[model samples]
Target: MGFFDRNIFIDIIEWLPENDDLIVYKYDRHDNEIKNGAQLIVRESQVAVIIEQGQFADVFYPGTHTLSTENIPLLSDLRGWKHGFDSPFVTEVYYINTKFITDLGWGTPNEIMLRDADFGIVRISAYGSYHVKVNDPVTFLKEVSGVEDAFTTEMLDEKLMPFVLSNFTDTLGEAKVPALDLAMKYKEIGDECEVLLQTKFDQFGIEIANFIVENISLPESVQEAIDQRASMGAIGNMNTYQQYQMGNAMGNVGEGNSEGGSVNSTINDAMQMGMNMGMASNMINQMMGMQRNAQAPQNQQAPPPVPSGPGAPPPVPGAAPSQLSFHISSNGSQYGPYTLDQLKQYVAEGRVNKDTMVWREGMPAWAPMGTHTETASLFGGMATPPPPPPPM
Candidate 1:
């Protein structure tokens, strides 16, 4: 009631803000004074700061404290108090929440230029959320909270957004994750960002409790390109895809539901078109360094069934077909019915050799070209007869 009355000053001070996101709260001490022996209550995940005039004087952790002239000599000296000559001192009491404030959002406010391997030069943006708390209240108040009585996560988000985006961009760029692989590397990038950002945020007295990367978005054109690539990947082997398309078309033709087979014929034509396209695509891919496995020809007629067992007669060479033309199996593939001359050309081209399997229409079964009479001439007759007797 009276300035000189010691009992009239504020007795105890504590804070419990109503707003959950409130990071800093200044206790209202309207017309009240911080005199000697005042009680200060600081709860868990909370910190109290005593700022005298414009300069910080003291900070209190989670505990009950009794303010005394001896304990707070700085406040007493700053107030110029000597004995009981001076009255209560004017000070600022701030409460900082040390609990993790969740759902604090961050994102790239603008598109960042990126040189992506798959898409070349492209622009990308990213978004994520994080949690934070005041790890160092004194520094936060002096450097960040900055004389503001009430501070909230929204205010903190505005300050940290640019830094978050900067770190995210650098981390993502350094990670060198391809646009096609960004979906798989979200966590990796986020983890790196969290590590890099902690170093920066530590000096500001804020701690990133957890960092997350929800999505790294690409440009619309780049996204469409990715989708197209994914679709192509889904198709797997182009040859197999073409076969599948043809199979579907043939299955439709077998249904016989179309009038005069018009639809069936169209389906067949489309399938053929797809096969041609697939062949061209394979060639282009090969030229572009996308090597594919060489597929065996599926349409080559199988060599006539071999007559097995030792009892089967080894047919006399003279009884073979008169045409001298034969089919040959080379490197696991069946080739044309070539004449002796054509076989010689094949030998010249290195497509046929001594061990090549050859079959003429009249042969009992396919026989090695070197051992078969009709084809043996291609590899130099089995073993030439010795001419030494004439010299002797």
Candidate 2:
């Protein structure tokens, strides 16, 4: 078309599959008519090449583009047509920037914190050219700030840091100690923090993945006291010095009596002394009895006299008898041949004397032959004969 033509038709041509093309529609401000077979030229924005043809053909590279027209039938309706570039859909990501961790008295930032501390403090920078694309552009424009600007790290620190610190401090304070000990408690505490941060971040559509406690400080004095008490308590019992001394003393006493001494000899002496005293008492009693018998009344004779016979001696007078004989019935049998000296021995032995029974040859029954002679009197119906005068 000529520059001043009014009846010139400018068609906006678009190619299939690759729309990166441009066709400029130039119109005449003053009224003018174009002749048949008028030639026109077209050019694109990116390339500097020019085209000459009867009908303008818009050729494009292998990409998307926009086309416009001034006077063609369907093309004129696309006068203000612009290219529609579909951007990646970006969901609103709410995170806390923990670059101010030192100022907030928290630990380092890590993936665990990023995933787990969704509503809690997190230190991060824009990653992988991540830009916000609004699904609800109207809501994005109206509700969210910085729509014109990118979501920067500084924005996170300025807007979210205070809320993160406040929430984190409150969470840490309210965090319960695990039911288990250190090794197990660390995992449990991390899990609990993750759950807590996830719940807090639910309003912003964030999910927590992990959490951690970097450092724990306990008082040195408390730890030392605990160690000392444990050490002392481990000693359950102790030995005493006095017990050792007592054991040593007992050992000496046991060792000193290795051989027996004069104890046996002393016991033998005491037994012999007792025997001698007993014998002397018996002899004195016998002598006293002989003297009393010698002085008895004639009508109360002490005993029958022994008649002198072959190889036998008559009784002695006023002298202790040399021999005495008696019999006793025991166990349904007659059982004695005791002599006067034998009687004295028996009396010393605490066996027999006044209680002895005698059976003379002419007597019908046994009689107690003694100074008190009731047996003789009961048997013979006569007084006991006086002892034959002691042998001279």
Candidate that scores best on TM-score: 1
Quote the positional error of residue 100 for candidate 1 in Å: 1.4
Candidate 1 collision pairs = none
Worst lDDT 10-window in candidate 1? 250-259
lDDT of 1 by residue, 276-321 (tens): 7677667556433455535523443345646454434444366434
The CA lDDT of each predicted structure is: 0.72, 0.33
In model 2, the runs with Cα more than 4 Å from the true position are 1-105, 108-145, 153-183, 233-392
Candidate 1's TM-score reads: 0.67
Per-residue lDDT tens digits for candidate 2, residues 79-189, read 222223221111121111111122212332432123212112332211111111112222222333323323333443354434444444455445533211333455555
